[model samples]
Target: MNVMIFLLLSIICIGLIFIIHKYFGKEELYFLAIIYAIVALMMSFKTIKIFGIDINASIIFDSGIIFILYYFIRKYKYNESKKLMLSILICMLITSMFLITTSIMIPSLYDEFNFSYQNMVLDNLPTIIIYPLSLLITMSLSSYCFRQLKEEEDYRLIKTILTIIGITFIEVLIFIYFSYAFMIGFKKALIISLNSYLAKVILMIIFTIFLNIIFKVKKVKE
Candidate 1:
């Protein structure tokens, strides 16, 4: 029953992302939204246990927060920090702020040992801050490598970024709905988290590719 439900939910999530990319794709971050969805799905399991809350719902909320963060950093350009609004540097700043805040708010969630406050401040605090920043760094690195190799003014960049953004929004909705609609426990959270990671990333990647093709057509008309 749980597996069936997950499969169904995965399909619905995929469809929703597709529609969002189609309609809201002013540029191409719509496709990149899927990457955010993929990351959320990956982290949803162990993290669901973090605050003793619904893992899926937390994923949705965190992703929403990231969106808002991304919006502000992009809109304000945060002290001329980025050449393009969607530059990798800006994305890092947005993602880092949220991750750092999340770390501060809910530290020591699943720690089996009682580390002292002093130790937490010196050791754990850096761990909390560094790990997430590493992820953002890796993503930024990937973007940089691509940018350096490709034509700087190419349109593909926009499409790719938009796809990632679309992935982010849809995953947020999915986790929010599932956490509310279903009663899930630790063991199930574990299993579903794995399923979500697998399904969401693979599906989003495929859908994002399709969205790119669609946008290519639209660009021609314009």
Candidate 2:
């Protein structure tokens, strides 16, 4: 019954994303939605029980999705070479394999750790902050690398940066929704959802400014 509800929720979210993609005409976001759906499906099948709260392993996998998006942006915006793309793909594959192996080998490792709800939530607070920060770093790194190889015209650069910001915004919402919706009731989930969006939006604004500065430097160079 739980699995069925999860699957249904996944389908509904994916459908909404597709609709947004269609209306917004962002092919990259469409792909992002699809990747998110894949992660959600994986969560439906397996979850880690921490402090009697079920957390999806797929949250870790969501980080991989951000990396994948970085690759996509690199390829499209900078015409990243096939060899480098292949190398990235291989690295992601190997990392995923290692995670899967570790999960299988030590499924019950955390089960022995007694955790109070307050302690568990406190422990997870850092992760909640770290995940979004890591995502920002990924976006920044991807943009920096691509800009080193090829600098777009000023207008194109702005468009690219905006797209990255928009995608980051969506990514934050998706991550927060998946992480909390199952753990909290609707009211608390709504509060977390708002806070999460605000946090990520601030991060996005900061990063977007940083990107703009880099683009200005590139323009000055050219």
Candidate 3:
């Protein structure tokens, strides 16, 4: 059930990427990337079991952000993807600030959900900080790699799959180490990170295939 939901969300996100690219413009893709980055940060606090292994629920959106970055790099310019990355970072920082401020605020007497919201944000403060930093590093790396390989038309799919695997692995390692290791113990954190990477790699591969198909179809239409 969780796996099904994960795939459904992945498909919807990938579909939206092409839809925005086709109808809207690069500006809309930037908007979508920022929205996904914010949602991914919020979802990092939640964990779900897939195939009986624990993983962050944010993987779907995170992969979407990467796909959008790759799309920018491939179709637009490398610098444009960097602009999108910086935009995402700025938006995420603003979001983190908002979460921090809201968490510290005293709630009104009638605010029933304030405690839960405050606790969730306070408890995951480390994650709020670390996740974006990890994202910045890994996304920089992913974009650099995609830029290097973008000119290779024959091996595009293979190179993209490999790049996603490498980027996702590093991202999981950095985020889980900084955010989860001390709190959950190194051993448990290692296990969860490995599980999370596996899930992310699978989802990324699926996104890569769909994205390639979209590009091909668009090329044919052009």
Candidate 4:
């Protein structure tokens, strides 16, 4: 069931990204990328079991953001992708600030929901801050790596696979260490980081292959 849901969400996310890019143009694609990043950050707090391994649910949306970055870097300029990354970073900073302030506010005596809201936000505050920071770092490194690989036309697929693995591993290490190491200990956090990297690489590979097929088909049609 977890595997099935993961695949379904991965397909939906990849499909929506290409569809928007196909019909809407880069401006809208940028908007969608920002939304994907923010949603991924918010969803990072929930873990789901896939093949008995625990992984964050946000991998689906994170894969979407990665595809957007890859698409822009492959088809447009690296600077354009940088613009998208900057936009996401700014938005995430604003979001974290808002969440922190809201979570710290005292609820009124008659309030029925504010406490729960505060608890949820404060509990996941580490993720709220860490997820985006990790994502931005990954985006920066991945974009640069992809840009370099762009010149290697003979090994596109191999380079793509390596880029995904390398970048996602970095992201998992940073996120898991800072977010979980203190609470769960270094050894447990390292184990979870490895699992998360595996899960992310799987999702990213699926998304990247699907995206390549879509663009190749469109190119053939054109």
Candidate 5:
């Protein structure tokens, strides 16, 4: 299935996240989670063709989800919001990837790989809502942890969140660029691949800078 539209949309979403980050910085992790959902929703849809019943396992445009999920697991423990929230994101990312890959590898015994917007709406709407709630819970825990640690640093949560999200976005941009570069179908492939990587990287870096400023402001306030 041709997922060009979804790819375009995902890149746009990344850009939107950067803009949002510039204005509202403390919610960096929360915003990143939302961006992941939007991009993943499309990739998840495109991957449905390949994944079958486990359509949720697929990753469409890139692999940023891996880093976010991993960082969450490694950083926080059961009591920690960052750790728990990241764990949930990790589970969803993995589950979604599994669903997508299984569909691709296995013959379509269950669902079709249409990758329509309606399909994504039906499948991911609930998943998306669920993530934010989980994020909220995680955020609460993080607040507690920070208070306990009493870290003098300003925007402690914001910085950590931005760092995690930024790194993940960067990793994904790399994966997508490399994946496309190797898959030589024609000249357009290289052009598309290079453009995709550059756009995402630039957007992510911009968000990081904005996030840094947010942190600075928070520290000053403290």
Candidate 6:
């Protein structure tokens, strides 16, 4: 969460990505690490108030990361590989540490309200439960889309970017339904859900496009 600590972790994560790429010949993990680190950095700088809950912006990056992991596991046929599974687990654990640390330590705009991870109580337990469940559900749903897109050769880059956005939007919806609506009643949650969905759709679209451009430039250099 601290800038110095985040920087140190970023260097270590990037180094690990290079090692994985070099040893296993999977460069996709490098890109994944880059996206994760970049998003983590961006998220450290801001928080948003949504549905009376203060959430970190890095939550927006969850589905994209999940999509990348799902894409690679399917692409490499690594579902049965223990080593690959271990590596993926390691990546997720590291990312979770970052997310947990940042989310717990950073004071949200509504710091006076005790409703998040740091102040976990009976009132917020359902939200905490739904958060990780929604992540798994989002990734599972995203797997179908990624599987379909991974096979197509035509406009694959564009397809991949769009898929990421679509899945992220789906995550927003799920988060709203399972988490937000339960926290607040359904009637009030509807409008907030719509606004959140649209906001995430636009943000992920722009983020995906920027990442696509970076990939293009990297490919050209290679």
Show the colliding residue pairs in model 2: none
User: What's the residue-level lDDT of 126 in candidate 2?
Assistant: 33
Model 1, position 147: C-alpha lDDT score: 41
List where candidate 3 sits over 4 angstroms from the true fold: 219-222
User: For model 6, how does the per-residue alpha-carbon lDDT over 1-222 read when each residue is reduced to its tens digit?
Assistant: 344543354345334433443444456564564466345434523445654544444554553455345536544664523343344445545555565565556476776763544543334444445554565566566656767866788997678767776776776667655565676688665765666666566555654554444333322212
How does residue 169 of candidate 3 score in lDDT? 87
Predictions in order: lDDT? 0.40, 0.44, 0.87, 0.81, 0.42, 0.53
Best candidate according to lDDT = 3
TM-score of each: 0.34, 0.38, 0.94, 0.91, 0.36, 0.55
Off by over 4 Å in 6: 1-58, 70-122, 217-222
Candidate 5 contains a number of clashing pairs equal to 18
Better of 2 and 6 by TM-score: 6
Candidate 5: which stretches are off by over 4 Å? 1-38, 41-89, 94-174, 178-187, 219-222
lDDT of 4 at 108: 89
Candidate order (TM-score): 3, 4, 6, 2, 5, 1
Candidate with best TM-score: 3
Q: What is the lDDT of residue 135 in candidate 5?
A: 37
Q: For residue 8, what is the lDDT in candidate 2?
A: 57
Clashes of 4: 0
Show the colliding residue pairs in model 4.
Answer: none
List model 2 lDDT by residue over 1-222, tens digit each: 654653454344334433433453344443553455345334423434433344444433343344344434543444443333334344434434453444444335366543343344343443343344444444455546545534555565556556655665555455555446555555654665555455444444444454334323321111
lDDT of 3 by residue, 153-185 (tens): 787789889888888889999996668886677
Better of 1 and 2 by TM-score: 2
Residue 8 lDDT (model 3): 84
Off by over 4 Å in 4: 219-222
Tens digit of per-residue lDDT, candidate 4, span 84-201: 8899889888888998898788788898999788876887877787877898798889888889888888878877988898888888888866786755578877777788888888
Cα error, residue 146 of model 4, in Å, equals 0.9
How much does each candidate deviate from the true structure in C-alpha RMSD? 12.1, 15.3, 1.9, 2.2, 11.6, 8.5
